[model samples]
Target: MATFTPTKPRTIGHVDHGKTTLTAATTKVLAAEGNAKAIAFDEIDKAPEEKERGITISRSHVELPIVSGSGLYALQGTNEELGEKAILKLMDADPVRQLYRPFVMPIEDIFYIQGRGTVATGHVEQGTIKVGEEVEILGLTQGEPLKTTVTGVEMFKKLVDRGEAGCKVGLLLPGLKHGDVQRGMVIAKHGTLKTYKKFEAQIVYVLSKFYLRTADITEKVQLPDDVKMVMPGDNVTATFELTLPYPLDHGQIFSLREGDRTVAAGVVSKVLS
Candidate 1:
């Protein structure tokens, strides 16, 4: 008799977390050492304004080379061919794809959440958000709202608690109706979320109404809550507050900016006063 082992799927996280840089480095090393072949995706659009602002307003998939076997490859831009080793697939699909189809119950609101936190809701906009998967926040071109990973899940009064990624999930958050879920709140296991009060982060200004000044608090509106304002100066570090409960953790990253500059880095701290 032969033993059985499962082959893991080829997947990659969102490209924002320096994944592209790492991929390029790995490809160079592989080619230089003659170990493997690397595939690259270089698609250009009129969105440098959005991308430089650190927001990926669109969804795309990219495939690279890993350690598997040899094959014909598909690169984004050109009809070029390269030797194959294994294939690495890079996809940027939000969990909402499952809920949407050609025609269906129209979602009254298209809620958006920035990266890697949690969103609380009875119904997703279109598709099912896989457990432990990061969903894209699609709206403004500033950048993808956030890259959040689903850590836990529950459906209705009963907890289906665990399920495989890429599967449709019907969840139920107690005492919370479908309408109660605001877009910004990342959904995960109830009570597992740590809402933030204050923190210091880096931000860039993009299509903003006014220039952000130091110490001048401002408010950013997302669905259920508003991101309290902070007068940040051109990609500078500053303090911020959240208007509602946010599921946050120490070192967890969110998007911010001062003006024209996108991509602000922040670390969570104590609750607001």
Candidate 2:
């Protein structure tokens, strides 16, 4: 077996970017090139539509074999518990009664995409917050809509006290008012947040109608601000100038736009001219 150390956490990117295709291709290529059956991986079948659409909807686990000894023995993937057999057993046992339970597992300090919006119920992996601690709801503009604090926390026999990381959390706010705030936004705790409206970022190009350069027309820019110009050159890197009043923070991930669609997604590097 091989032993490896990770410098950065590994999480699956969502579908539509050919995540599934990428997985299959990479898996087959590795298996063909390698001598052994290569370690196994767990693919999360979270959505029926994902199967139909031929895209990976849930977070799946894949084992990457390290080249160490002649006969490898160790195996590593994302999650070992949520396998297909375990999931099938759970689903077949008593879904109706078990629907009101918190996750059989726990997720903390991780990012996930919302496949659906459903009622929230249960004791979360992490305890729920009180009415004092501030929380920031993101995703309204490409993050999640997080409602921190216990101002409206309630007890439900079926619902959990807190929400897990991977599942969707529905908030029942009576007098809340957010106009035209649709899906695909992220919500989180509000604090001394970071900003970098006009900065450089590293990105991987997925879909491109035509090769882009500085000042190329793009609709991937979605900040609540105006863009002065765009520059592209370095491999998976670009320079962006925003005309918004909000702040852009370091390490923020955003889907870059050319005109009306996302061209690439990237993390903020540095504010450049």
- Model number with the top lDDT: 2
The Cα RMSD of model 1 versus the native structure comes to 16.0
TM-score of each: 0.34, 0.34
Q: Model 1, which residues run further than 4 Å from truth? A: 1-70, 73-81, 87-161, 164-170, 173-175, 204-235, 257-273
lDDT tens string, model 1, 1-273?
Answer: 222222322335564643343344345435555755754423322388655765444443323334432222322222222322222222222232333321111112322334423324334322343444543322111222333345444432233534323432333223222344343334432223344444444444322221121111234422113434434344444456544334344454445454646534444433342
Could you tally the backbone clashes for each prediction? 40, 51
lDDT of 2 by residue, 117-147 (tens): 2222222322233323454433214333344
What lDDT is reached at residue 48 by model 2?
78
